[model samples]
Target: MSDTNVNPQITDAVTQANVKVVGDAPAIAMGNLYQAAAKSTGILFQNATGTQQQGALAEASTNQGVMQIYAMDTAADAATQVKVAETGVADNLTGLLTVLESFKDKGNP
Candidate 1:
């Protein structure tokens, strides 16, 4: 206990272990960097796929709404034609045209 001398073999072993760690540091660091980069790339791909799917859903919804609007317009036109046929006369615009003609005649005079 009084002699504070460390054995030469123990000192050499410790020194070799420290040197091994130092020599491997760059390889270990590079491996860690590559792993992190790969994980980030995977996450980016996942996000892109999710966005694409959402866009597809929105497009489909918009197309469905447009079709519904077209159908409604067609139904309205058909109903108007039926009414005109049943009445045997298309008088809906006649009154408006008469008023417009009067206004035109007044303006000309």
Candidate 2:
């Protein structure tokens, strides 16, 4: 055979492939890091959303409780007013009966 060797060409091809892979390593690592950061940000957003929902629910519950208390107070006030009116009516009826009795006594005399 001729003295031309193919080993040098093979070595050069292998070396070039290795260099390309080594050069791309940083890019691959950066892409992976970016994906991880995005995932972390999504998790944080979800947590914040959950907290806000909880706060809204708590506020609604407190408002409902306050409304209930107000309704009870209103009902109690109405009941007190009715009781006072009934007492006044009863007093008036008693006075009228007493006056009628006095008129009857005078007529009998």
Candidate 3:
């Protein structure tokens, strides 16, 4: 009978596959890490943008309130001026009536 021996081909193939996987592991891990970092940075920028918009809205609301107060103050001042002008007109009318009454009395006498 001839001696029989097992071929080492299958074992060699498995070893090469394992070596390839091990050699590529670092690159794969680094790629995954970079992806994660990009996602994190994107989230951070989105939050910052939201915060800025909120701040701008708050500022606009505050400015609107200030404008309303200014308008009210201006209206009050105008009302005061109108009241003063009406009082002056009433005083002038009264003085004119007194002078006309005196002139009529002197003419009748």
* Model 2: per-residue Cα lDDT over 27-108, one tens digit each: 9999999999999999999999999999999999999999988778787789999989878977989999999899989985
RMSD of each candidate relative to the true structure: 10.6, 14.9, 15.0
Task: Show the lowest summed lDDT stretch of 10 residues, model 2.
Answer: 68-77
lDDT leader: 2
lDDT of 1 by residue, 1-109 (tens): 4979899999999999999999999999999999999999999999999999999999999999999887787877899999879765457578778888998898764
Q: What is the C-alpha lDDT of each candidate?
A: 0.91, 0.93, 0.93
Clashes in model 2: which pairs?
none
lDDT at residue 3 of model 1 (Cα atoms)? 71
In candidate 3, what are the lDDT values of residues 1-109, reduced to their tens digit? Answer: 8987757998889999999999999999999999999999999999999999999999999999999887787877899999898789779889999988998899754
TM-score head-to-head 2 vs 3, winner: 3
Candidate 3, residue 12: how far the Cα is off, in Å: 0.7
Regions more than 4 Å wrong, model 1: 1-3, 74-109
Residue 26 displacement in candidate 1 (angstroms): 0.9
TM of each candidate vs. truth: 0.64, 0.59, 0.61
Question: Which residue pairs collide, candidate 3?
Answer: none
- Please give the lDDT score for candidate 2: 0.93
